[model samples]
Structures are given as structure tokens and as C-alpha cells.
Target: MIKSVIGLFLPVILALPLAAQEDSDVLFTVSGEPVTVGEFRYIYSKTNGQDADFSRASVMEYLDLYERFKLKVARAREMGLDTVVALQNELEGYRQQLADNYLLDKEVTDKLVSELYRRKQEDVDFSHILVSLPSLIPADTLAAYERAMDIRDGLTAGNFADRAAEVSDDAYSKNDGGHIGYVNAPLPGGMYRLEEAIYEAADGEVVGPVRTPAGYHLVLKHGSRPAYGEVEIAHILLRKSPEADPDMQKQRAEEARAALRNGESFEDVAAEYSEDDKTSRQGGYIGFFGINRYNKTFEEAAFGLSEDGEISEVIESPVGFHILKRISHRGIQPEAEQAPLLEAAVRQDTRFAEARKALFDRLEREYGTRKVDANYTSFVNGLDSTFFQLSTDLSAADRDATILEIGDQQYTTGDFVDYLEANARLRSSLERRFEVEGAAESLFDNWTDQQVERYAEAQLEEQFPEFKALMREYREGILLFEATKLEVWDRAGEDTTGLEAFFDAHRDQYRFPPRARVLKYTVNTAEGTDAQAVAQAAEKNTSAELIEEFGTDGLRIEEQVYEEATLPKGVTFKADTRSSVDQVDRNSAVFYRVVEMLPARQKELSEARGYVIADYQDQLERQWVEALRKKFAVKRNERVLAKLIES
Candidate 1:
């Protein structure tokens, strides 16, 4: 209730600024605290959007609401609500959330997402010979790079497919001469480097020794085509068996195709003939699939159909023979429609990390970061093999030694130690088998990056006026919510005597119109049940008793009270009387029993509690605002206000 109430007035609060120029004219003052003309104008134009006409009436109406809002905010501060630990924490949380969006290098992220979306419109046909790196040790990495370069050189003289078949480490594609066939971006995570290489290469151009996590790639771009986006297909499959003749399997597949051609529904034919257990019950549905998701032959057959509901001739694949019916096809979506998906994909890819690293680098330059190499070397030298065992305690080491300096802030050895201890679980993971010296160096780099990001985050409010304004709005919003809840919402709900008295004074306003308490009974007539017998039982007994007598298998009885205008159109009310049973349809009959006909009367407090409470809350809020206005001193500058309206 408090959030809903505050939401009604949030636009005004959210648009206001916490600070303005010292020389700006004061539009108003509440208890000696000034609200500048700049602040008021900013909020007014923002809250009203295009409706902020400089008309005097419009200005005055908003001024009144603004003054009331300020009065509540002032009262909240007087009560020390702003100093509450919970609210301060909440404000900080909101600040962090807002800062996360602002801290990114948005230009880089946008470029990546846009690139992915554009590339998604066309599928790339590419092949690559991957020389797998045995490890990330310098020698192994250098060897892999050299080997990939050697392969690229050989590709210029010899057949690419023959070389790939003999030497490529990618087992899946090497047999097909490194041809992975058509693929679209965004590719899986950690594959961004390969994805980039594939899309950037020209037709028939062999590029790379590109470095990816898996190893180095020597890529050959096999040209491109407009993407075959996705297809929804149902297929009937006849599996190959050594015991059965190949001709028999082919005959079965042809029979299924003939049934489909003879005007039988694809769903019925597939259920009767498809041997794929997973899809047989679901009408052989394979759902929607795109390139690289299935074998090249199956995908080609499925996407080859030009029209929905078109069936393919029996096609052979490695696993079985299939007769496919194309259910639907979806082409590439427009950029705007695809952007959100592209953005999500980009974030999951390795490129997002590179973008963030770029952001950190920019911040490092701006903040004048300098490393204390001597101190970092000292810290790393002090570590032992126990570091990976989570047993190293850096507390006894040089706590005062500075490892990095960013602007006026110094990150000491003690801070680095704290970060390491905090990440002990990650440091102890089975996948990380780093030596002590190497581990310490890696941790130090990460710690330095974290320090740089923190320093940048700390300076956001000071550096960005828009960020400061948002923080101020959220702070005041929290105060206003707490104040209103305490003074109006909670009081109205908890002060039972006051609520009852208020409802009593306004009782006539909540009187019920002429109404009836009715019991409606429905009986299923399709089973030859007697509708007349059900109606007779409903007239004589209460709904619960009727349910017990009829066993409730085909009888449904409900009791409700409805005003005259709201009752069913043909329903007539009379005390202790039942309406004639009427056939609602061929299979159902309904009757209504009027338990009591009620005339207009005052509603009890319990009968209208929700509405009464809402009204009571409004009354209390008005009184509270009036009291606050009396307590606070509000003085508006008429000359400035007049100028604002004229401008």
C-alpha cells in the first residue's frame, strides 16, 4: 500500500535535484533549507514531460503538491528517518545498481551487440584446422601458434581439405575436411575469438593463427549465404538395422510419405509410422531448429521445403531414413527485435569481459594509477605452497606496504590479503593448479583491477550530476515512504477504534442497494440426470445440504449475494422461492433459489473494511499534512515564481 501510494507521486520526487548552483535564485524555503528555481524547473518539466506548459494555473497546482511533498520530507528528517540504518543501506544498494550501468564502456558493448545482430542475418560457411594447445605454459602456447602458422602456409600450396583430414585436431569436423558447415553468431561462450575470425574473413580467404581458449585456429572462409534461420518440422523415421534388409527400411519410409500424400494428417501418419520414441507421441515434432543444431543432410532436407505443410521425399541420413513435413519457418528478425537477444548473447560471450577490461583500462588512465612493483614482488615472494591449500596467512606479512596507488587512494598489502582470503574458495578450486608464485601474481592483477573499479565507482556521484540527482531522488523517496507509512498507513490500519468511529460517521455512504442472497445450482443433463429433482432439492435445502444429498458428481451449487442490477438478467427474487429450472444448453440446466431479498441498509464495518480503511487512510494523511504544514515554515519567492510562469 505504501509503495503504491508513493508510486502515484514518484515522478515529482524522482525529478527533483538535491543540489543546485549557489547563485541560483531560491524558489522556496522550508525551515531555512532552500529549494532553488533550477531544481523546481527541472522537476516540473521532467514530471509533466510535454505537458509542462508555462501557464500560471499549471505552475501553481504543481507548486502546491511540491510544497506538500517537501513538508513530509522535512518532517521525516526531523524524525531522523533518513538516518535509519535500513533506509541508508537501501539507498546505497540503489546507488550500486545505478552505478553498474554507468560504469560500463557502453560504446564498446553496443558495437559488439550490433555486430552480432548484423552477422546473425547471414550464415557463414567456414572451415578451420585447430592445433590444440596442451597447456597455457609459454612453450606449449608458442608451439601451438607456430604449428597453426605452419598449417596456414601449407594451405597456400596444398588442398585445404586433404591437409585438414590428415592433421586437424578437431575430431568432429576434421573427417569432413574441417567443414563445420554453416554457422551463425553469437557462438557459444569462450568462442568469441573464433566467431570474430570466421565473420571477418573474405570468401576463400584463409585467415588466422587466431588465439582462442581451446588453441590456435587456421580458418578458411568458405563463403556465405542468407541465413536459413530456423525450421519447425515433423518427421517419420525408419531406423536401419543389420538384421533387417535396407530395402525394407526404404519401403517403410516410402509408405509413410504416401500416406501423407493421400490427404492423411501429418500428425496421424507420424504417430502410426515414426519410430523415434521421443517425438512419436508429440506428432513427431522436432520443434524449431537452426543451423549446426542437426546433421547437415537432415537440416538441408528440412529447410529445403519452401512452403509450410510441404512434405519431403524420403531422405537418407547416417542414423535413419526420414520423411519430413515442414510445419513452419522463421527468418531472421529485424535488428530492433533481435537486439535484446543479441545483447544477452554478447554479455555471455568472452567479448563482454574484454569490453569491461577496456573500461578498467580507461579508468586507470584517468585516475593516474601507478603500480608499486617492489612491494608487489615482495608480497609474491613471501607466499608459499600452502597458498593453494588456503593455509597462508598474510596478516604477519607487510601490512603497511603499498601495492598500488590510484589517485589519492593507496591499496596496501593488507587490503590485498583480505581480498585473497575472501576468495579462498575460488583459489582452492580443483581446476586451478597454479604454483604459489604464479597464483599470487594472478591474484594481484585481479585485486588491482578491483581497486581501480572501486575508485571509479566512488567518484561517480561527484563526477556525474545526473547520477547525483538520481541518488537524491531515491533518498527522499525512501524518507517519504517511511514517513507516510508511519503517520498514515500504519495508524489507519492499527487504530481500530478510530477506524470504526470514522466508518460510523460515514455509514450512510456505504449502504447496500436492494439485493438478494441467492443459491445457484447446475446439473448435467447429458447423462439423463433429472434437472427438476436437483431444482426441488435446492429449494428445500441449503447449498451444503444439497451437495450432501446429491453426492456432487454432476451437481454444482454456489451461494452469493448480488445487487438488483448485477443479478443474472432473467433472475427474479422472492423470499423462500426457487426459479424454474431452465436449460442453459443441451448438456446443462441451471436454477436459482432466493434465500432472502434484502432492501437498502447501512453496511457493517466488517462488510466494507477494505474501502473504509482506504478512506480512513486518506483522511489521516490529509490531517498529517496539515499538521506538518503548520509545523514547517514555507516561504515562496513570488517574483521568482512569477518569472518562472512567464518564461
Candidate 2:
């Protein structure tokens, strides 16, 4: 019975770890339970493949977690909270979610990865010579045309590369004698236009004075070749970066090789001597670089060196001090590796994800649960509740107030909103999202976030498994909104008492930005017109000067990019008073005298009232809900759930 929870792993754990063939010697104990090095090695090999993503917990950690899980399960069984209607329903839902994920594996992802796995990639090799043409040349047309024509004729004559040297104006290739290097090789994706000529041509065949956007290209076809399986080599490098101190690097590389040969660990030497931080820590152990992954200097050194444990002398490159050890090599073709691994990974993920979802759906259908929120409305179906409630006091909050007193604690809604915006956990929670959304809507738009969130959550949960992850994603987003809608805001009664107290306590939050509604005129056709011409044009049309001395400098106008307080850092270009803008657009431009030129500045709270309200509501409701959760007599009873397998 204890085995079922850890069933999938027991064999490997007990087998001394056979996760892979190479590191089958490193062992790890499962807590105090005696385990062997073989077991640890096997786990590490499989896990190492996934090490780039550290989000997933490690095998050792998971083992420790298992111990905690056992203890928790015992406690949960003793409490018997699992039998409560809500708790039972939630558990069943999770179990069903688990099963539905399995079905998905069977239905979708597995098949997709398998199909993609069978596909083949065709590797090709080719080379070409290029000629760049000047755009609309202003030189002597007759002379330039004659020179270009002569080069073309020479290219058609024989030994095109040699002709390219003597006559081709492209100075880069003229010296190299027109060898474009390896086919379809290490060139930037944007610069590989010559591949078309190379791919279509036969070996030793010279083609094209083909004209492309870059220039005229005289291409010689090198035959297409498939990619080699893979290579294995060990190497030591001497780097040549000015920052690398070349002589020191060469000496280090030499010492590294000597240390390796003298029985010191390759890993230790690499960590101490390799200048490249990313690989040096692993003892110069770079897993595998394929195709044109590395630069020529390092790639050649690594690939050209001989087999396992063998080390070469210092090789020079831009990022220097390389000492390498070749572990093993695989000739496994693209199709070979992709097909099986892709198929297996896809199958597993699809089945697990889908079946878990299906299971959840079935459970929900069998024993339904209802979800409720602060709006006094039921958001999810399948439950009974007599009355819904929203805090009446919260509904009346003053958008201008800085500190909202809830019981003894005073909350700064502005401060809370900033915190919420930055919290990673708050942004990711599934069920707690909708209310926050409602708050935001009520702020920027007239829409009430709580209402919108309720409807959205209800509709989405019904669409389960189809968009569960998506719904889960929105669950947090929407709650963040609902939280923005909490009723604590209504408690802000407006009056001398309210305003005086609010102003005195939180007066600092209300600072107004320097603002002006200076008149602006839009000059639609002044494209590249000098500033003086613009002012003259304005004067001629409206008898008012938009700028005193406008000329080539462009129009000098008062503009907005949003509120100054909220303005972005550095030079702002937009209008609206709170924030800075990098550049001004037409929206902030106003066309109108000294008496009527400047407009009054707005108070920050008044301008940002909508935003403040929404943010405040979210903080209130989440706090309220958390308080209620603590008050509830919640318990977890796993007896019924545990009975399933036993039965």
C-alpha cells in the first residue's frame, strides 16, 4: 500500500539507478534509508538532460519531499477534513484533473510528436561568389557600365575566381581569390541568399553572374552534402583575447593538460584554468555542440583532437583558454534521435496532461461544487447558498484617500497596488484571480471587475480541460482584478472630516505634477519644413505665432504624453501629467494667447482616481477572503479518497 504513491520510481530507486549507462556509479541515499551510488548516477543522467530548467525539483529533493508527504498524509487522515463536502469536492477535482491529463496524452500530444519525429531534415552544402551593385551610381555611367561588362565577360572566360580577383570590384573576395568557403556554412541567416544558386548547381560547375539585391553574384556550385553523424574529440586551447592575457592563458591550457595526464581530475583543472565561465566550472566539459555551433578556432580544436581523455596543446581563439575532454559520441541521425525522443516525450506529456483533465471533469460531474466570490453572486455552479454579500463599507471608498483604515490596520492602497503588480505568486494564482480584474475594470472603464470576473470564471470552468491551463492562468489575472473592486472603497465618506483627516494623514500621495494646457497647432504638411517656415505658415493661417523663432528645428509646442507623475524616466515625449514620454505625438497638441495659453494643473489623485479605486478593491477583497479562510473550520479527510484503490 505504501508503494503505490511511489510505485513508478521504486524499481529504479532500488535498482541502484539505471537512468542511464554512463554515470551508473554515483550513488545517493534516500534520506536515512540506505541507497547506493548506482541509483544516484542513473537519476542524475536522466535529470542532467533536463538541468537547464531548474524549476523542477531534483531527485534528492523529491525524496525528502516524499518523507514530508507521508507525514502530511497521516495528519490529513487523522483530521478527516477530506470528507467535508467542499474539501472532498476539491480533492476529487484535482484527482480528476490528473486523470483527464492522461486522456490528453492518448488523444493529442503523443500523436503529434510521433508524427513530427518521423520527418527528415535534408542537409546541403554549396558555395558562391557575390558582386554588390551600387544603388543608382552617380559615377561616369559609360565608364562604369563598360567596367561592369568587362568583368562579366571575364567571369564567363575561365577560372572565374581568378577573373574575380583581377576585375571584380568587390575588394573582400578579390584577395581571397573568390573562395566563398564551405557550402551553406556558418553564414548569418539573413546573408544566405547565395544558397539558392549553390544548392541548384552541380559540383565543379560555375554558374551565374546572378544579380541579387546585394549585388551581382558569379556563383560556382559545390555539390550538396548531407551532415555527418557526429564527432568526438578532446582538446586544450590557448585564447587570444586582449583581456585574456594570452601568454597566461596558453600556460594555463598547458598546465590543465598536464594536470589531466598526471591523474588530477579533468573537472578540477577545467574549473581552475578554463577562462570561459559557462563551461569551465564543469571541468571544460561542454556536453555537445553540433553543426556550426562553435566558432572555427574552437570547433576545429575540439573536433580535430583525438578520442576520450586525450588532450591537445593550446589552441588559439577569441574566447580563450580551452581545455576539453570528449565523453562519448552518437551517430544517431536526426530522424533517429528525434523520432523516438519526441514521440516518447510527447506521448508521456499528452497522456498525463489529458487524462488528468478528463479525470477532473468526471469527478466534477459526479460531485459538483459551487464557487462564490465577494460580489454576492455564485461564480461556479453546483452548490447552494442563500445570500451573497459584498462589504457595504468597502463599496463606498474615497478614490482620493491614501490610507484606508480596515479595523485597526490602515492599508495604503497605492502601496498595495504596487506590491501586487510586482508579486510573482499573486500574478500566478488560479482561483484567486477574478476579483482583481473586476477592480481594474471599474477603475479604467465603467465595467465592474467582480461582475466580469464572476461571469468569466463560470463560463471558463465549464469549458474545462479544453482551456484549463488558460482558465487557470486567467483565474489569477481576474482575481487580481476583483481585488481591485473590493467594497472598502465605499467607506471613504467625503466631507471636511473625511478630506481633512485623509489629507493630513496621506497628504504626501497627492502631490500634483507641473502641468500646462498650452495651445498647440498641428502642421500636417510641414514635412521637413524649417522651423521658421512653420511659424510663418502658422502666422499666415491663424495670425498667432506657435513658436517665436521656428525654423529648421521643427515646431516648439507644449505637449502631453500623460501625467507628469506617471511619466517615464528620461526625456518624455507624450502628454497627460503623471508620466514622462520619450516623444510627443499629435494627441497632446492644442491650437489656441498668454491669458488663455496655460491650462490649470490637475491633482494626481483626481487624475488617477479610476486607477486608484481598482487597485484598492483588489487589496481589500484578498485581505477579506484571507481573513475568512482563516476563520473557516476547514479540514482535510482523505479516508474516502484512500478507499478507492483499496476497494
Candidate 3:
């Protein structure tokens, strides 16, 4: 087993010195167990990838951290934390999720994603006629394909839309004469086949019986064009109340236009008058948006502006009139820059299933996934109607029957039944319309995909050394976390007597700066006009009394004890004084009367408990790490250390 594990990393192992390669390239030894260079580099890279702080650490600095880490793992294993049932279950669950990142056909995914990125640079507009059919019914499926093919045969540019409106099953597109609008490629969802067909066809050419989850489609390529990219706009809005007159709203919009013509800053005008609360505060700046994102009138007007700082005339929408100013426009980005986003979007889409199906088809051909036609038919027939009912127990004969053979692996009838039972709870309708042959065919296909993924996962460690290293790191990480929680974190929190003693010792270290116990109130006025009046009233009465006298409406009032350092910006004062000061903008003023002064002093244990506890935990962990280091016989090779420093 050890030799096999080492063999998985042969390529990397061969890069090391002959002595080191044969003996696993030992960088260090903890308690006589070797820590290989490959293992250290794997952890170093993983940590550095995720953490900016660690990425900046030099090899020597990281080596110390890594040594401490291995000591913890060693301690955890020695204490048998790795054998805990809950920890094992948690690790297994994490392993399953992590396996997905490693187990995929990445070369195939990357190629498809690249193809998608290239195509996304050009948008396609197509019209289609659908002939829907469920795949389980072979004859019906063929008939749908034939219908699509027939539609495609006679399709002409002029009649395509007319025929689509008359016969297409797509309700939304039918009314628009089968126009599905502009779609970005690799069409998301089970539309990969359609996307491929659309891209391959010339403008005005008819193509199809393209198969998708929605069934067969006869698609007419309307045209393709360079991407429109995205636009950013700033708009000045004049919101009209439902009760307000439309003419007045239009008049307000025109007034805003006049302000722009008169050379007033657009941002200033928007901030002073625009009624759109969302964008008004940001000087009416609407962030970048793609086509079809905004309402029709807004979208059209925003896109129509050709140059930065160009303003649109009054445009009417349901809300009111808007005056749009062009901010900027972006063309298609470089493929390398856009691929990550495109890949992520495509992977999450259901249409990507077609691409996955393509991969599966390729894998099946390569690995020899053979269905035992006779056994498959017999297995389906043998299943009772109760087989569809999730609650009903199934006693499948030939439970071990090889339904599918992928290379040396055989997927059994028992596996299919297991998948079906586990999945059928939410698919109760399957029981009502269950057909042995058809249901079996659909189930087998889905099961085959799962089996393929599992097979890929099993081979990952051997085929990809990085995957093995990563899994090993995660497994140890899990053990370390559980062990640390039990030994350090949980214990520190629970040791109240020790915690209280620690807090008392550190009380003098925690002190509050000079602060104020004060009465404060704020009043808004045009250019600080009411500043004197408000401050005068505050000096004579309490905040509540002032509020009552001032009728409570539109008066801003508050009273809080604040440290001098934590005071609201724009206000500055020494304690033990009454003062009234105008705001920075001179738009408002604050009134304050210092009731008392708070001198700098040591904080009470209760007041500093949270910080003190955190500090105490850190101290405890430092002691624990020291104890672990002493417990383990740690030895580092000077030669290997030198090599790391040189690298």
C-alpha cells in the first residue's frame, strides 16, 4: 500500500535526489516519522493560496509554522482523536464535497468553457420550432425528431417566423414569431445541443432536429453579431406621484434638462432634485448594466446615448420621466479575463448537462460501458409495480447482476434499486406512471453518470498527485481542528476559575481613555440658521423637553456617553464644557453639555471579559504548542532547509 501511494507521486518523486526519492524525500521527522518534501510543499501551497499573510511568509518562516502544525496532528493521532465517530463522519462529508473539485473531467470542462467563452463574444438571435417529447418513449421521441426535421426541410427566412408562430410549442417566442432574442453561447441548461447547432448554421439557414431536455427543435439562424457588452449611465429622475399631473412631471423633467444646458453639474442637480431615492444619494449614478436588465424605455434611452457626458431628452416610463447621461461603455473583454466567470456560470446551468452528456458519451466509448441488454430487460420486467413506490420493499433478483460494465467495474441491479429508492421519495409521480422498460432506461443513464463520477474519484489520487496531497492535508486538518477544540478551545472557555484569575492579572492592562458623560442633541437647519436657538433650548431643558417644545417633527435629538476618541466626526470638544458648533457643511449643528468627566482608568473584569478571554485562549494555545513540541522528537535536515531557502 505504501509503495502504491508513493507510485502515484512518481513524477514528482523522480525530480528529487535518488536517495531522497527512494526514501520519500524526507524534509523533517517528527517523533521519527518522516515529513516528505512533497507533503510540506502541498500544505505550504494550499495555505499560501488561501491566505495573503501566509503567502508572504518565507520558506524558513513557514517551516516553523509547518513544524508546529505537524506536532498538533501527531498529538491528535496519538490521543486517538482521529478515531472519534463524529469527527470521522464530518471528515467523510467534507471529503465527498472536496472530491467533486478533483473528480471532474477537467480537460473536457476547460475545453468546453473555452469554446463557450469564444462563442459568448458573438451573440446569436435564432427562432425555433419545438416538437417536444419525453425520451423514454422511443417511438414518440423519433416522431418528434422527424417532425422537427420536416419543419427544418421547408424552412425559408420569410416563412420561418410565420410557421413558428403557428406551430412552435414555445409560448413566449411564438407570439414574437419564434424570436428567442439574443442568447449568449454555450447556451445555459440542456440547450448545449441547440447552441452548437445554432453556431454551426449560417444566417437564414435552417438546422435541426437538435435534441434537448425540452425535446427536438428546428432552429432558423436569424443572425449573429458582436456582443453589445455593457453600459453605465447616470440619470436624473423626476418621479410623478400617482395623484400628480403628468404635464407637471414632464415640466419638471424639462427643467432638469435646462439645468444641464445651463452648465450646472449633473451630480449636483441630481442630488438636489432627482426623486429616485436609490440613485439620488449617489448623484443619480446607476452602475453598469447589461442589455435587457432595465425596463424597456429606460434600457432604450440609456443605450442610445453614444458618447460619455451625452444626455438624453426627456424619456417617459411608468415611474416618471428620466434624463440619461452616458457614463461609459465596455466592449467584450479578453477571453482569459472572462473565462472564469463564464465557466462558473455555465457549470451552474442546467443546459451544461448536454456538455456533461457529451463527456459521458466519450467516457463510455473509451472505458467500454456496456449494457447487458438481455439482463437489463429481464431486470426491469422482474421489478414489481411496488418498485416505483419508495416505501415498498424491493427484493430484486440478480441483485448482483451486471447491468453496466465500465472497464473492470460492474454496476449491479442492486445499485440501481438503491439509487431509485433513495431518489423516488420526491418523484412519487413516477410510481403512478411506472413503465418497467422505459423507467429502467432513464434510471440507468443517471446511475451511469454517478458511477462514472465515483470511478473518476477513485482514480484521482493515482492519476493526480496534487489531489492525493490535498486530500491528505484536509484529512489531517480535520483531525487537528477536532483535537484542538477538545484540548484547548473548549477547555479554555470552560475553565472559569482560571479565566477569572487571568482577567484579574490583566485588569491593569485594560484601561479606558478619558471620555465624557454628556447630554447631546443635533438640529438641522438651512445653513445653521437654527443652531443658536437649538443650543439655547438644550442648555435650558432636557432632550425630551426640547422635542416636545419643538413639536417633535423634523428635530434630530440624541444623548449618549461617548469616549473622546470615539466621538462622531466633525465635532471636537474638551470635557466639562457646554458648547454649540456648526456642522462641517454648515447645514446643521450639534449642542452638547458635559454632565461629568470620565478619567482614564483600569476597566472592570466584567467590562473587559471578552477581550481578556481571547487573550487568555491565545496564551493557553502557546503553552499547549510548546508542550506538543517537547513531546515530539522534531529533527530538520540542514541540507533540505538550505535548499528551501535557496529556492
Candidate 4:
């Protein structure tokens, strides 16, 4: 059943019409808003749309929408919404917003190229035996030596996996024959010590008895990877629970099939039966995700299926009963989608390729030799001091033994450092962090990701043609929401008369959760300082003076407390203080005290006035954004929209 959809879709790929000029004459109007030919063509070029010459049918759909839009805008004018203070404020807000995008584009894009051009190729593939306890194998001895030797022999003899299956200690990799396959060139800088050991090995050679805080490792180099991108996939799933009996499940499935055959809803059946509560609530929607997002079994089954809405039969996975439905599949998932894996690969390749090519080109242009000069020795040796901490001090005298060559040109120490420093700068600029006390740099990036903002911007420009002049509509819409919120929603600003009336009308949502008042303190060590000195010191010093001198952030003295679950991480009940989102750190804390507990009580207007105002503003804005939709008569170009719909 699934095979047929793919068989059909593959042909559709071929039959994708050679988009013609007809698509251009097609006019799309949204409430008297004319979507120009240039705009349509440009949009189609960037997206998956029918780019044929515009036709009457194509243009008519847009015209209908344009009519409705005109009607709404006309109504808005009648209501004097254009002159509205809220509208003017909203337009001004987006003016700042649009201006910010240009600066952001330049900042992010300029940094991408210089950052890509750096480095060379040196990779490793190693395997290991990890013992979880450190002290057990600290001293190098015959026993530790013999154990590593034995593991080595087993690996060489094709039985290393069997031995690892029986006795290896690292919970992460022991079961898989000590296999942690090819990472790029060097292992990434931190986190996994075992990964580093593997990267430092030579091909077909055994290295290690390398000590980590966890245990000793004997990594053997096996292989490496050259260059390749990755792929992505998505699927819908049908799952069964452990409580389900095989016979009973099959029977229920048969009943479901009969219902489906009798014209019953697949959604209803899914809602009633799917064990996956998250997707089941949305009628079994899993949306788009990448490979490796699920277990090997689930990944295989879903990608192996084809076409949206095509469901599979009872397939066993670690997560139990599954009836997977294929939704969409993509190639080499977006860098951000499979970020940890894909971006790492791309970054390494970009650095190595750019660095190697530029160096090679420079050498050919200048020296023109197939054999490298002795100067490369100093260049290669210099890297030891520059890039890594070394056990042995390197000297100019030792340069004679080191032979470093790129094609015919020999690299000198100066050349090596030049490239090294250049690469280091690029890395710094791209990865530089401001070290926000609590907020993550990437979290802020994600917040600024313009997901909803871009959509709103595009639609606003489309809806209002003189949008530059009329943007006040959108800005005011947003600002009115903001201003109304500020007036009533200020944390410390609540009008008793207004709140009392609000409370009298809607008392249900105001009922408060059990809460408390917390005096919070957060102390942290600087980066790479893994020691817990502050946590340790807190036990000895509780004085506000000494504690203030200690590295802790002090939140409000009388901050409202929340339920234990309501408190974010780094916060907990203490005899004296509480934590908040502000208390973040790699280092743990000691004096986490809850100074006072406030019982859940009826919420007065004063207590919830801020929230009520915010809610009112949100409702008003939603109403306006919705009303804007009505003002513009809308028409969907389904023929042009096939791509998004199918995906």
C-alpha cells in the first residue's frame, strides 16, 4: 500500500510542469491590494510554486481576496482606525523592527566566510575499554597493561565485541563492541574524554590506556570519513502500549479496519486507540523531524514508508506497537535541524578545505616545488606549542626532524602560526559569547529567530500596500496591546476599583496556586571552574555581608514564591531562601532555602491585575489580526501551493 504512493510520486517529480509565462499574467489581489507580476515571479522563483504565465483563473483567485481586503480596509477607515493612536504606534514599532533585520543580516552573513577558511586535515578513529571508577585503575601496572593488551588482542581477533559485551564498564559504549565510529578530524574540545582519545589515534594502531576521571581507555584506531552531507526524514506513527495483549490488539485492529471500511473517521479511531498521547491528541500528527530523532527501528520503518497519510501495519519497535504514516521526507536535513551532527561536519570541512586550498595555491605560486623544504619541520613542530599543551618542549633544533608539506611547498613556523592565529580569530568572532548571567546566547538567538515575526511582516505588507504609510495599523495593533498591558499589568501597579470589578466578573481564573515569598541567591564560578567552592562555602558562611562578597545574584527581597513544580531549575525549598530562573550555573549551590510559604488563596484583582490586562490586550490584538484577515478577501493558489501542502 505504501509502495504505490511512492511509485506514483516519483513520476510526479518528473512531470512537474515546465512553469510557463502564463503564471505571470495571473493577478492575485487581496482586498483591492494588487499583487504585482514582479512580486509574484520573484516569490515563485524563491519558492515551490507554479511559475507559468499568469492566467485568468490564477489572477481571479487573488482578485477575490483583494476585494475582501478592500472592504475591510474601507471599514477600518470608516472607524477612523488609520488615525488611531494605536495604529500609529504599531507602524513605528515595525519600522524599528524592519531596520533591525538589515543590520542583523550583515552581522550574521559577514562572519560566515572568514570563519569558514581555516585549518588542515588530521583525523583519528579509536576504540576503548572504559572503567567507571577512576581510583581503581589510576596506577599503571601489569594488570591494567594486560587488560588493555587483552582487549587489543580481542579487537584484532574479531572478538573484541564479545569481550566488551561481557565485561566492559562504560554504560554509553560497552555494549556495542566499544565502537564510537569516525568523528571528523580532531574530536571536539570538551565533554567526552573518550571521544578525544579515539581522535588522537593513527589508523590500524592501538593507543591509550588514556585516563579520564571515569576510568582508563585503550583506544585503537580503525578508520575515518572524508566528506558527505546527511539526509532527513519525517513520519506519522500509530503506537500500542505494553498493556495491550497481542491477540486483543489484533482483534481491536480488525474492528478499526471494519470501521474505516464502513466510512468511520481515521482521526476518531486514532484518538481513541493510539498510545502516544502527544500525537494522538492531534489525531496522530507527528509533523516533520529528522533521522536519528527516533530509535533505529522507528527511523527505519518511517523513512521506509512513503507518501503522506499512508499508514503501516503492526510493526514492532522498542516503543511497542506502531502503525507509522509517512508525512514527508527531505534530503540532508537543514543544518539547524540536525545541528549537532550536520553543522559539525560542515564546519570542519569548510575550515579544512578553505585552509588547505589557500595554502596550496600560495605555495605553487611562490616556490613551485614538488618536494617540501626543511622549513616545514619548524612549521609542523610549532603547532605543538601553538595548538596543544605538550609534555616535551619543542625547539628550533628539533625542526630538522619534522617534515611538513602541502604539495611541493614546505611550511615554515611563521606560516603555521599565521594560519593558526587567523583561524583562532574567526572562531572567536563566530563563537564569542557575552557570558550573560543566566540567559544563553543561542537561546537569545532562537528567541530572535523571526519565525512568527517574518510571517506577520510579510502578511502585513501584502495586506496593506501603502504599508509604509499604513504600517501604523500593524504597529498600533501591537502597541495598543503593549500600552494597555503597561497601564494595568505593571507588576506593582494595580488599581483597586478596577481590579475589584474584574474579580467580581471573572473569579475563576484568579484563584491562585499555592505560592510563597522567596529571598533568592545564586553564586557561580567562572567558566571551566568545575570546582564547587561556593556551594561548599555557603555551608560555612550565611552572613549577608560575606554572602554578598560571595559570588551570588540576589533577586528581590520579597519575591513571590511558587509551587515546587512551578519553580524553574536551580530553585528549591530551603529553610531561608529560594531560587528562580536567575539562578543558573554549572556549579551546584548549598543554601537553597524557602523563607516563607504563601498558601494558595482567592486571587484579588490587585493580585492578578497585571495578568488580566495582558489577557485583555492579547484578546484585542487577536481580534484585530483576525479582522485584518476579513478585510482582505483571501484566495489560495492551490495549484501553486501544491508543494507546501504535500510536504
Per TM-score, the best of the predicted structures is: 1
Candidate 2 deviant stretches above 4 angstroms: 1-127, 136-150, 156-158, 167-173, 185-193, 211-213, 222-226, 229-238, 241-248, 291-293, 306-310, 318-321, 328-332, 335-647
Residue-level lDDT for 617 in candidate 1: 98
Query: What is the TM-score of each predicted model, taking all chains together?
Result: 0.72, 0.31, 0.59, 0.29
Cα lDDT for residue 54, candidate 4: 42
- The segments of candidate 4 whose C-alpha lies over 4 angstroms from its true place after superposition are 1-129, 133-150, 171-246, 253-268, 306-309, 333-647
Residue 404's lDDT within candidate 3 is 81
**Residue-level error in angstroms, candidate 1, position 447:** 2.8
User: Across residues 1-647, which tens digit of lDDT does each residue of candidate 4 receive?
Assistant: 79999898987676555333333433445555554444444443333365433455554455444344444454455556667785677666667676443322323222332222111122234456664443453364446656665665535525555666666786767777777544443234332345445544557666666655555576666766432222232222334556767667656655555555676566776677666667776767776654345676766677667565556655666655565556555544333454454335534543334443444344334333332444543344333323322223324444334233333334344433333344453323333343221122233222223322333344445444444334434543454444434432442245545445555777787777766555444444343322244444444565465446442342112235667676645665444443333325555322344656777787776677678766654444456546757655655555544422232
Arranged by TM-score, best first: 1, 3, 2, 4
* CA shift of 528, model 2, Å: 82
lDDT of 1: 0.85
Q: How close is candidate 2 to the true structure, as a TM-score?
A: 0.31
Indicate the residue-level lDDT of 259 in model 1. Answer: 86
Candidate lDDT scores, in order, read 0.85, 0.45, 0.78, 0.48
Error of 4 at 355 (Å): 15
Q: Residue 153 deviation, candidate 4, in Å?
A: 4.5
Which portions of model 3 show Cα errors greater than 4 Å? Answer: 1-24, 42-57, 100-108, 119-329, 334-341, 344-351, 361-377, 383-412, 421-435, 463-470, 496-508, 521-561, 568-575, 581-590
lDDT of 2 by residue, 116-170 (tens): 3332132344334555555645464444555555565645424766766765666
Cα error of candidate 3 at position 484, Å: 2.7
What is the C-alpha lDDT profile of model 3 across 1-647, one tens digit per residue? 99998899997777667645533668899999888876776677667785523232567688888888889899999999888898889877876877775545464557677787778778788888888885758898888888877777778888988999988988978998888877766565677789889988999888878888898888889898897778889988987787878899899889989998999998988988798899997879988986657776888788788998799999999878999999999977887888788778777866456567777787778778898887778777777666666687655778888788888998887887788778886435655565755666677888888787677777777777877787777789998887788888887789999888988877788998888777766666653346677777666677678778765443577667788777655445465567646464555556667766778899887888788878988888899989988899899987876664444
